[model samples]
Target: MKKEELIPQYLQDELREINDIRPPYSFEEITKLKDLLDHTLKQEKQLEEAEAYGAIPKEEADITNLVLTVKHFVLQESIKDAIKQLENDIEEKKRELEELKRGN
Candidate 1:
């Protein structure tokens, strides 16, 4: 199935925007986001089951809030990952500069 098919229609536009950002998401990052969405859906199912079983109050089983929270988390994590990769690249460049200076 297409990666787009894995994402819900409501989230497609947002995820596309994220994927289009500078530095963009790597293929691995996109896969991770898909996995996160899958996990969130599973969790939502569990919540519904719990509510049906009277293990949790119906009012507390808020799937919309859960989905939104997960979406926010995914965005934050993707940004953090991008920042970390950029930092690593900067550090590597600094090390290469030091080596060049020593050679000169």
Candidate 2:
């Protein structure tokens, strides 16, 4: 097996792990992961532009890094959004409870 084939497999495995764990983590953790993802995305774009203009060595390494970074981003966003949604739902429930308590 070549390095290229190995990278995709590793990337997929990493993403799967992230997906599996994201549901239980806190919002702050997820936010931090999102920041990391944003940084990786910037680096990935830089690498792509560099490749477009010239022949670059070690391109595979950059691509693998990008894939992992993207996986992180996907998990981070998923968890963060889920937390936000749950928070909103809780807030709505609280309001309803308060209104019922007041009988208004």
Candidate 3:
């Protein structure tokens, strides 16, 4: 999907509805989320570089490996939540589309 379509501003506004504690996130939260995403991205890049150039050193790379594993676990957990949200959104959209098709 196009970047514009993927992150529509209206959806961003809608996401704020999920935040009831301490109001919606501020720019700081956006930065933090960006940093976390970037860190995961960098880890993926390192894994690719290791594969392409040479294998990670078995002893020294252990920590990085563990970190990557833990990051992946957290990502999977987030993905599950995202999937649930997406499923609900899809159902709602489907219902709306059907209503429109029926001229309701």
Candidate 4:
């Protein structure tokens, strides 16, 4: 299939897999997969309901990577937000410094 056709198909298959909340290999590894299992179930519940309303399924690859991506975002959302805030602060500081230099 063409790359354009393949990408959306891949994303859809991976998204559907979230509905299958398999147990992690180790309970101690809960930091990653465990949290995601809970979140995924919630997200999947919504997705399933949406599908019932009229959502169409798509395509996939290893699928594990897709799960991993979901887990990463769920785990790191706070960190990502903090990073964004810090970046904005840094940009503002730079602008202030430039204004100071211009006035000097």
Per-residue lDDT tens digits of candidate 4, residues 1-104? 56546445544554454334333223333343446456656655665565566554532332434554664465455334445666777899999999999999
Q: After superposition, how far is residue 6 of candidate 1 from its true place, in Å?
A: 14
Pairs that collide in candidate 4 are 9-59
Give TM per candidate.
Answer: 0.46, 0.50, 0.40, 0.31
Best by lDDT: 2
Against the unseen true structure, what C-alpha lDDT does each candidate score?
0.64, 0.67, 0.55, 0.52
CA deviation > 4 Å runs, candidate 1:
1-8, 15-61
Number of the candidate with higher TM-score, 2 or 3: 2
Please provide, for model 2 over 1-104, each residue's C-alpha lDDT reduced to its tens digit, 9 standing for 90 to 100.
67557566746665665566555456665665566567656656776676777655565657766685677567567756767877987999999999999996
Clashing pairs in 3: none
Tens-digit lDDT track of model 3 for 9-102: 5433423422321213354544444465566667668876885666866543554555556665554454455556567778999999999999
lDDT order of candidates, top first: 2, 1, 3, 4
Task: Flag the better candidate by TM-score, 2 or 4.
Answer: 2
Q: Which 10 consecutive positions of candidate 3 have the poorest summed lDDT?
A: 14-23
Q: 28-99 in candidate 1: lDDT tens per residue?
A: 765666565666566567766787788865444563445456666766677677767768788999999999
Model 1 vs. true fold: TM:
0.46
TM-score of 2: 0.50
- lDDT for model 1 comes to 0.64
